[model samples]
Target: MIKQDAASRTIEAIHESVRTYLKQGLTNEQIIEKLKEENLEPYYIETVIDNIYKEYEDKKNLKNAILTGSILVIVGLVINMLSYRLSENMNSSAFLLFWGIVVTGIVTIIRGMILYRS
Candidate 1:
């Protein structure tokens, strides 16, 4: 039982290390080497690194999507307000385009928020 407990704790520590190293932008090779130095099995090291990379990619995509969506919404609102104030003789097509931009921006923002929350 003691051996089992020690082993579990060690594994947990390794997982924490993996997370920290990934956040520090360590490459797979470097992570693997560090894990090896800790005497972790090669298979476990590879698996952990792969999982971390997948997680990192997911987080990065979520952040990028959120930023892009926010920018689009802000830009759309600014353009719409400017056009409305500046142009008294705006045509129907221009109006449609302005509204379209606003709608698209709103949709993107909603999508990004959903992704981030999930």
Candidate 2:
């Protein structure tokens, strides 16, 4: 029980140190070096940094995907409306192309939604 308590305290201390270094805007290398000086394991330091970076990347990607998807959907809708309004007779080829754009836009939006949820 004492060992477990000590381990918990140690983990909490490490987390606090990480948060402090991050708030100070230290680079990952600097933070790693500081943690090393504290005798923290290299694996633990690397894992923490990796997780932080991965989460940041995930958020960025999610934002980009959602924005792109929304734009594509809006563009597809505009194109369909323009085609209908501008053309007296819609050709079969153009109809197919319109449906294709709409389908692609829908798929992209769905993919973005999935990424956001994940």
Candidate 3:
């Protein structure tokens, strides 16, 4: 029980320190040196760094994707409306293409939300 408690605290400490260093915008090498000084195992340090970096990148990418998807949807709609107004003879084929673009954007947004949640 005592060993488990110690291990848990160690893990928490490592996570906290890593997050702090990340927030400070320290480089990877500086973070590694600081972790080594804290007497953390090399393996734990590497794993934590990789995990944290991946997590942050995933979230960042997800946000960008969602924004891009929304933009695509809006642009598709605006173009469709303008085409309809400016060219009264906008044919079925053109409408279908615009709808396809909107659908693609919606699908992209849904996928991004799923990834962000997970």
Candidate 4:
């Protein structure tokens, strides 16, 4: 039986090889040659490709979320600032700021829920 560490190492090697092939858009035969040059087993390339694709998708989703949240936060800040100028009274300004914060929180929570549910 293969030791767990050794199996993990082999999988990592395969994963790296798959990433290389994807980056280079290489054929399976070419990928095998590349792996051979690196002294890695090429037979596991398909498994690696599958794993890498899933990893890429996960990373992409995370990146998109960060970008969306950042944009929304910036927009919320701008809205809060502008609301102060639009309101003449101090109480109105304070209320606008409070509502702006509440809106931002709600939007962020909704985004989190949507992402988590999916």
Clashes of each: 0, 0, 0, 0
Which candidate number maximizes lDDT? 3
User: Whole-model Cα lDDT per candidate?
Assistant: 0.77, 0.77, 0.84, 0.68
lDDT digits (tens) for residues 1-118 of candidate 3: 9999999998888888888999999987889898898787777788998888888899998998899899989988988887776566744444333787788789889999898888
- Which pairs clash in model 2? none
Worst 10 residues of 4 by lDDT: 93-102
lDDT of each residue in 1-118, candidate 2, tens digit only: 9999999998878877887888899988899999999888888998877766676777787777777777777888888877776663654344423666667767777886687677
Give the Å error, residue 41, model 2. Answer: 1.9
User: How far in Å is the alpha carbon of 35 misplaced in model 3?
Assistant: 3.2
Question: Per-residue CA lDDT of candidate 1, range 45-102, in tens?
Answer: 9997777677777778777777776777788888887776556566433442366666
Q: Candidate 3's error at 108, in angstroms?
A: 1.0
RMSD of each candidate? 4.9, 4.9, 4.0, 5.0
Ranking by TM-score: 3, 2, 4, 1
Q: Give residue 79's lDDT in candidate 3 (0 to 100).
A: 80
Name the lDDT value of residue 60 in candidate 2.
83
Candidate 3 Cα deviation (angstroms), residue 53: 0.9
